[model samples]
Target: MARLDIKRKRVALTRELARLKHDLQARELDLEIQCRAMQDTLGELEESRSRYAELYDYAPVGYLTFDAKGCITEINLTGAAVLGMERTRLIGMPMSVFIDKGSCQLFFTHLRSCRLTGKKVTTEVKLAPKNAAPIHAQIISMPLPGGKGYGSQYRSIIADITERRHMEQEMLRMDRLNLIGEMAAGIAHEIRNPMTTVRGFLQTFMRRQEFAHIQSQLDLMLTELDRANAIITEYLSLARNKPVDQSLQSLNKIVADLLPLMESDALLHAKWVVAELPDSLPELRLDAQEIRQLLLNLVRNGLEAMAPGGRITLRTAVEDNQVVLFIQDQGPGIPAEVLPKLGTPFVTTKEDGTGLGLPICYSIAQRHHAQIEIETGNCGTTFIVKFPYPK
Candidate 1:
């Protein structure tokens, strides 16, 4: 009996020991699975962090953080690049440092509005970086929550919009050109016919002795009619229906032929005309008469704007795949108010000017699928006409 009882106790102990071992093994397996899961989660987090860093540093739009005082607190790599500065150097600097002098007020206004409204504010401003061209940037700023005892902060995104603005201006210019062309086509003949009849009768009356007392008046009438006729001629030039006769010709040779005529007019105004024609230039398809008209108008316009001893430079060069003709003048630059309305009909800066010359130039360029760009400053003005190479 004692032996049997001892055997039962041993069996029970062995069973208990086996149960304990199973529980330990199960717990170890669970721990191993959990460790692997933790490692996978850590790897995912690391990868996500790296991706975020790259995105922030290399974003297309510049990102900047500012304090309540409008000082830059942080700048991403893209933002630094846009400002043409190192990221480490930009931090803690005033954001206004990079804004153009003329646009500083605009930036402050945007900053104040964002902070006061605690909302997003957007504005277009020109940012002038050191030794770089002014950049047109669309700035979007939003207020950020401040920590305890801290003032409000801001986060801003800046996108370069210079090209977009240029495109928009080009579209507007084309629209204006189309409108002018339509108006010209509708009015050219209607206005010319009446002027012709009036001028013919005035000429007939001036020749008779019965109307000799008012002969001066008839002459005046004739002069005014001639002026009116000149205006109508310019209007006709803007008509899109006018056919263009394009022939492949040397631009340099044409310019050379026109120089004597231009210089003759320049001599009258005491202005010096200089030709910077290259020895050789690519031949382009051009309307000889129209190009002559265009050059005459531009050169005369430049000559009229200058005082005695001023210089007018006529230059031609190849840039990219286009031929560029530049007419530069040494005169007071075009007025700010007048520059924007340059090609509009009846807009002129001169008192006795008919305001049709530039519009005619623009019309000619439009017919040729060319582009006209003007650059003016306090020093002078340069008119650049670019013609595309034949495809």
Candidate 2:
């Protein structure tokens, strides 16, 4: 009986040991699965962080962070490029350094407004980046809460609005052109008829024996009437009913043919004329007569503006798929007040000028589907006519 009892105890002990071993193995398998899941979560987090970094750096608009002192704390790639500087070098630099002198007050006011109200503020300003032309920028800034004993900060988004501003200016110019066209059509016929009748009477009087003594005075009067008639003709040219006869023509050849006439006029004014024509230029669809008139008017204007010994440069080139003609004069530049009013009817700087010359040129350019851009400063003035390439 004692042997049988010991056998039963041994069997029970073995069964308990087997159950404990199975429980330990199950716990180890669960831990391994949990470890794999943790690894996957870590991998996903890393990928998400990388994607966020790329989005922050490669955004289209410029993004910048400014400290309480208005110095740059953080800048993205686009922001650095807009300022024409390297990100590393721009760090800690004052934001005002990139702002144009004329727009400093505007930027400061915007920043102050944002900080004081703890709200978003926006402004348009000119930014003069290094090694780049001044650009019109629309800046939207929001106040950022500070942390770790720091003061309020600013986050700004900057967008380049130069093209938008140009479009606005162009629209205004077209409005002026339309108004001039309407005025020209209304009065051109009335003025030409009276001028022509007076010119005919003056000629008839000059041929008579009784008017022989005053023939010179009569001749002057006739000349004045002819001048008036010429002005009316130019004014009439602005009529849209007169269609342009366009043909594929070489601009270089046209310029070459006009060189002699331009030089003669320049010499009469005691100024030198230079033509810079490229050896090869693309042909353009244009009205040859109108283009000739445009060149004559622009060159004559340039020559007239200069003093003796001043030089006028007429150049033709291809730029950005367009044909360009530029007339530059070494004058004291256009007056500030007159600059904005250029190409308007009867807006002239010369005492004897009827102010119709530039307006006529503008009319011709518009008919040819071209644009005229003027640049003037203390040094001189340049008129650039850009014609689109034939489709």
Candidate 3:
């Protein structure tokens, strides 16, 4: 009995030792899993911080962080450059100091409204340079929702919009073309009928044998007569005082149909053409042929403006219930001084060019109840044709 009692105690001790070892292993595994989770969370937080840092440090536009009292707290390099001061110098300064004198109240009102209602305000703001003329900017004020416990941070974004303002001025100049088309209506119609009568009489007289030597002269007269008729026809189209033959036509299809002709001309001039058109465009009521012709004139002018090996970009989009086509070109854009003469009849760059092209485009827009806007600069020129959707 003593021997049996010793064996049983030994077995019980062995089993207890194994149970303790298993418990220790399980505790170590739990600790390792928790440590791994913490590491992963720390990595994610670091990545998020890096992204925010990049956005704050290198933003392309002016970025300014301010308090409700209009005190600048932080600003990006772009913002500092715009304010004509160093980043450190601007941190504690009043933001109003940077505002153009005439626009201080406007900036103040926008800042107040954004902070109070958490809304955004954007518009043109002029800022005087330290040693130069004033610069125009498009300012956007946004309320940066405060941190979990902090509620006093708001920021504003500003971009140099001097180029855009210049574009608007260009569009205003092109608007004059609309008036020239209005003047050509009667002259176009009256001259067309007389041209046809003159052509018929000249053709009959030129076929006579008695006038052999003068036949060549008659031929020259006939050629000039034809040229005159063509001019009248073009003018009539320009004075598009007619109604639209509305039909459901796809814009993409229209572009496709004209592609071959458009490409041929562009290729002959050694121009690079890019068409950013979709497989389909929304069908709308339009006089398709007229619109095509309008596009042709604009594209042709673009091709002519540049020498060999130039670039043209064509794109279309839908905005504000209107079909807008953008035709752009890389060329020395229209000079601001001479841009105003674009659509006046007989005003042209080429020796034999008639300035009626743009005016005709304007008349086409009027007939379709559309609007055309032209924007040009050293980089390029873009013509936007806005076709409205009938409600």
Candidate 4:
């Protein structure tokens, strides 16, 4: 009886140990599943962070974070690119260093507005990046709450507006040209008729012996009349409806025909003229007289700008499927203020200039469906005329 009772007790103990071992195995399986899930969740989070970082770095517009003291706390890749510097190098640099000297005050005012109002602020400022031309930028900034014991911060977005500003100025200039065109159309013929009559009578009197005593005076009067007539001709040229006779012709031939005259003028002015015409250029549909006038005006302007011994280089090439003519001069660059108003009527830098020369040049270019561009620096100035290929 004692042996049977001991066997029963051992069987019950074995059953309980088996049940405990099964329960422990189930818990281990659940723990392993939970560990895998946690690992997957961490990986997803890391991936999301990486995507966010990429977006921040490669955004089109610049993003910048400035401390309360206006020092750069953070800058993205685009921001660094706009500043013409590296992101790591831009950190902790003063934001004003990249701003135009003229716009430093404006930048500070923008920062003050953001801080004082604790709201979004907007400003247009010029950025002077190193080794690059100045660019116009519109900056929109929002005040940010302090974090990690840091003082107040500001978040900013910068958009390059240089091209937009240039377009606006060009539109304004075109509007002025249109106005001048209207005025010229209205008054040019009316004024020229009387001037022609007066010039004719003066010429008649100059040939008379009765007016021989005042011959020099008559010559002066005739010369003045001729000047007035020439000015009227320029005004007529500015008329938008002026006719142009387009013909398929070689640009090199035109330059060759004008070379002797250009050289004569250069010799008179104690300057030199150099022509670089290519032999294998495509024929362009052009108004020969208009092109000749354009070339002469540009060459004369270059000659006038230069001092004695200065050389003007004339070059023609085929670029980007367009015929390009370059009139380059080694003269003092145009004034910054005068650059934007180059094609506007009555805007002149010379003492005796009528200011109509460039306007007429612009008008001729427009009539020919060509574009005239000016590149001026401290060293010199170049007038580039581009004509599209004939279709």
Candidate 5:
């Protein structure tokens, strides 16, 4: 009986040991599965971090972080590019160093407002980068929480508004041009009819032998009348509502056809005309006559701006899906004060200029959906007419 009882206890102990071993194996498998899931989650987190970094670095506008002391603590790649410096070098630099001399006070005031109010503040200032042209920047800044022993930090976003400002000015100029055009359209025909009658009577009188002694005098009056009529014709051209006959035409061909006339004008002025036209270019929807007139006006202006020995270059290029006509002259630059009023009627840099030429050019460009941009410096001035490709 004692031997049987000892055998039963041994069997029961073996069964209990086997059950514990099975439970331990199940727990090990569960831990292994969880470890794999954790590894996958870590990989996803790292990928998300990389994606965010790319978005921050390559944003269109600039991003900057300023510390409490008004120094740059962090800057993105775009900000570095805008400042014309490397990101590493811009760190910890005073932002005032990059601000235009005239805008430093304004910047300080903007900074102070954000810090004092601990709220959003905005300001427009000119950024004078060492290697790039001055940028018209609009900054929107907001205060951030500061750490222990530090004042309020700030986050700044900088946007380039140069193009927007230019567009506003252009719109304003267009309004002025339209006003002049309306006035010209109303009065041009009325003025030309009476002048025509006066010219006809003057010509008839010149033919009479009795008035032969005063023939020279009558001729001068006739000449003056003709000049007045020519001026009126230009005024009619300035009418912005004038219809344009646009067709698919080769700009290069038009330019080639006008080379002879342009050369003659240059020669008359004892100047040189050089053509740098491309062999081929995209066809533009344009009015042939108006394009010719536009080219002639720009070329004439270039020639007049230059000295006798100077050269005017007519260049045609394709840029950014647009055809660009460049009339460059080797002349002293246009006056700074006169640049803003360039397209206005009767505003001319030349003493004898009617100031009607450029206004007419502007009017034609608008009718053809083109833009005229001027680039002038001490070296010379270039008139750029950009014509967009057909939609």
Candidate 6:
């Protein structure tokens, strides 16, 4: 009986030990699985870091990082190249230094907004190249998060968009000029028959000298016909297919010559004409006829801007190797909305005006490689003509 009891106790002990061993082995397996999961997580983190680095280094657009104080901290190779500076040199330098001096004020205002508010900003600006010539840039900036205790920093993506912008402008200009040419050609052909009929009738009627009482009327009609012919001539001039006849022409001489003629029409309105120009200035390579006609159109527009007893000033100056001409009038300044599209054909602020004057002026300026700018306010409007030096 004692042996039987002892055997039963031994069997029970063996089963209990086997169960404990199984539980221990299961725990070991679980531990190994957890360890593998941890290894995978670490490997994934490393791969993500590599991918971010690759993107940062290989971005096509120039990337840059700057502190709130405008000092550059890090710049990609592309950024350095765009700025025409070494990465080491760019670092610690104020990013604003790269902005063209003429536009720095505007650029800084936009920049300050992004830095202080942690907002995103974009601008199209001109950057001064190594040779001091300007190159266009499309820049995007944003506030980036940084390490704890580190203040927010700015990151920029910049692209050299000079050629792209130039091409776009050229294409638009060509389209506009083409449309003007088609219109002018069509109108010239249409007016030719009427002009011939008027000329023949005037000649035949004038030979009847016995119609002395009607001579004055006949002369007036002849004058009107001549004016009509002049208008046609100008319309045809707009479609000039020949290259611009570039010659050094004095802008002051042109303006001076046109003053008497411009004020003649305005005499009925009793407006005062003002001329502010120096004795002489350098000449520009220009088409004398085109420029004179443009000036006439602009001055006539100025004259029509005012009521009786208003003032008009035509001013000229030499600025930085460019001919600066201003036609200002104390009349109803152009509306802000219309200022941008003032050069578009058939767009006019005046009820009776054809709106072709400015478009023609713009085309002639383009041929001369000149820029036309308009500044209008409650006080007055000024049309500024800036002619570039011939290349």
lDDT of 1 by residue, 194-254 (tens): 8889888988898899999999989988998888778767777876667899999988888
lDDT of every predicted structure (CA atoms)? 0.88, 0.87, 0.79, 0.90, 0.88, 0.80
Residue 290 of model 6, lDDT score: 84
Instruction: Write the residue-wise lDDT of candidate 4 on 350-376 in tens digits.
Output: 899999899888888888888899999
RMSD of each: 5.6, 4.8, 12.8, 3.9, 3.5, 16.7
Question: Candidate 3 regions off by >4 Å?
Answer: 1-190, 212-216
The TM-scores of all predictions, comma-separated, are: 0.74, 0.74, 0.53, 0.81, 0.84, 0.54
Candidate 6 residue runs with Cα over 4 Å from true position:
1-174, 186-191, 198-231, 240-246
Native-vs-model 3 lDDT?
0.79
Candidate 5 lDDT over residue span 229-288, tens digit each: 888778778777887899999998998899998899889879999899888899989999
Worst ten-residue run, lDDT, model 6?
A: 234-243
Compare the candidates by TM-score and give the number of the best one.
5
The parts of candidate 1 lying over 4 Å away from their true place are 1-60, 67-70, 94-121, 126-135, 142-154, 239-242, 332-341, 375-380
Which residue pairs clash in candidate 4? none
Off by over 4 Å in 4: 1-48, 116-118, 130-133, 145-151, 307-309, 332-341, 376-380
Score candidate 4 by TM-score against the native: 0.81
